[model samples]
Target: MPLQPLLALTNSEPEEVECPAPAPAPSRPLTAEEYFSEQPPEGDIGRPRHLATKVQKFKATLWLCEDYPLQLQEQIMPILDLMASMSSPHFAKLKDFIQMQLPAGFPVKIEIPLFHVLNARITFGNIFGTETPVPHVQSIEEGDRISAVIDDACFAIPPGYKDATALDDRHCGLDDEEGLLQYAIQQSLMESGTQDDQVDVWEALRGARPVTPSPRSASPNLLNSEERQLQRAIEASLASLSVGPQQAAPAPPPIEDDLQAALALSAQEHSRLESELMEEQRALDEAIRLSLLDK
Candidate 1:
């Protein structure tokens, strides 16, 4: 079947053929473990990634608002760290306490403003007379003090941001009570020093005798007024214990007896103070409840 091929008469370019691109491979859905184990996106390490997004945003807002000096910022680092590392339930409790302080129907935007007020309170609230104590996570008294501070600060916020509630007449009473208690303790220590040539309650509790300061080593001028006063009181008490050369030293009590007596006195004073504080706190709570009801 050999046949002769016909020749093309005209010169024509060969037609070009177009081929379609192949479709992309389908992506498989990740398992729960794989998704959960994935790393966060880069540059978000500073954020508390374990917390809910809302809390993260709140913390970010707080960070932006904080413009304190480096020294003060450093001083508050422990508190800030405690807050950041708090468990979800603990944080929720803290947030609830904060909310309880706010007026009803206040906008959610007030949270940041309210926090600004709170930060100011924490900055200035040196209730301990010296540097403010860093609150422990599990201390009930510390928790109550924080709540009270928040309550006071809530009232201090500008009225334009939210409706003003009646300010508690006995606001900051806990702080006042604490100051009074410290003053009483100092007074009791001074009196005890004058009555007997024994170690003061503080030194006894610490299981050490007070070292008399050398005349050459005077207190620094940098000490605050309160600290200066305390130093003077200690010096006066020490001076009263000085024995005259002519007077014979009386037979001293056993060290064990003195220590036991000091401890017992300290325990009694502590119990009394605690009872007083509890009573005052109950009164304050009732007052606050009534105030809220009136609104």
Candidate 2:
């Protein structure tokens, strides 16, 4: 009777308790690749979550001279666009401004030039959306006055041009590279304006000129293929200019003397520029070496 009563009392068995399995220990410390592979949680990742949705607008004014050629302007616009679109670590701070203030898909866009004839201004609108267009010239009168000043200061006659209209559309095309070079030469000479003391223009031009191998011989060891090609192009351009239609009338004694002097000055300037360029190249190479060492 006692055995039956005990058995009947414990009809239900004790409930089994569940336990979690222990986490397996890593075989070794995770490599950098493995550690970075596991993505952080969305909330943990820090990024600009709230930004302005509307596109921002900005304007930049290029105070080019009134006589600045339309073809040059067209060429310049694309260059400006290219410069703006180029990626640079220097522009890191602009990231937030670009994302929040600029147009949604395009980070940067230099729109077509807007020529304001009344004020003689070229406006390049951008999506920067920060500052208003700077008023370089307040009125048409001011613009006219500025233009007059520039003309008087910059565009004087050189001994090379026998006719006053030589600088006009009749002489230099301003469309072709040779014409551009001639135009530049004329402009430099004009700016110098028979001032014996002023060698600034020639020196500046010489400094700005791209480095290329000598035209007489191909020094493959000295210059890269690209440089050799550039040298050839420069030589061809110069050759074309030399063989181009020339005035039949001989230059006067004084003009001829002046031309000879100019040529001599240019030769001296070229030698000085070459020496300076070599020094600069050495300095640049040293800087690169130091930077590599630091890295």
Q: TM-score of each candidate? A: 0.17, 0.18
Candidate 1 TM-score, C-alpha based: 0.17
For model 1, the stretches where C-alpha displacement exceeds 4 angstroms are: 1-255
lDDT of each: 0.39, 0.37
lDDT of 2 by residue, 172-256 (tens): 1224544444433543454465313233344565665423322212333422432343334444444554663773333323323
Reference-based lDDT, residue 111, model 2: 22
lDDT of 2: 0.37
For model 2, state the Cα shift of residue 12 in Å.
99
lDDT of 2 at 235: 47
* Model 2 misplaced regions, further than 4 Å: 1-255
lDDT of 2 at 24: 39
Which run of 10 residues does model 1 get worst, by summed lDDT?
A: 1-10
Q: RMSD in Å for candidate 2, one decimal?
A: 26.8
Candidate 2: residue 78 lDDT (0-100): 57
- Model 1, 189-255: lDDT tens digits are 5445641334655577778865644221232342243334444444443444576767654433233
User: Which TM-score value belongs to model 2?
Assistant: 0.18
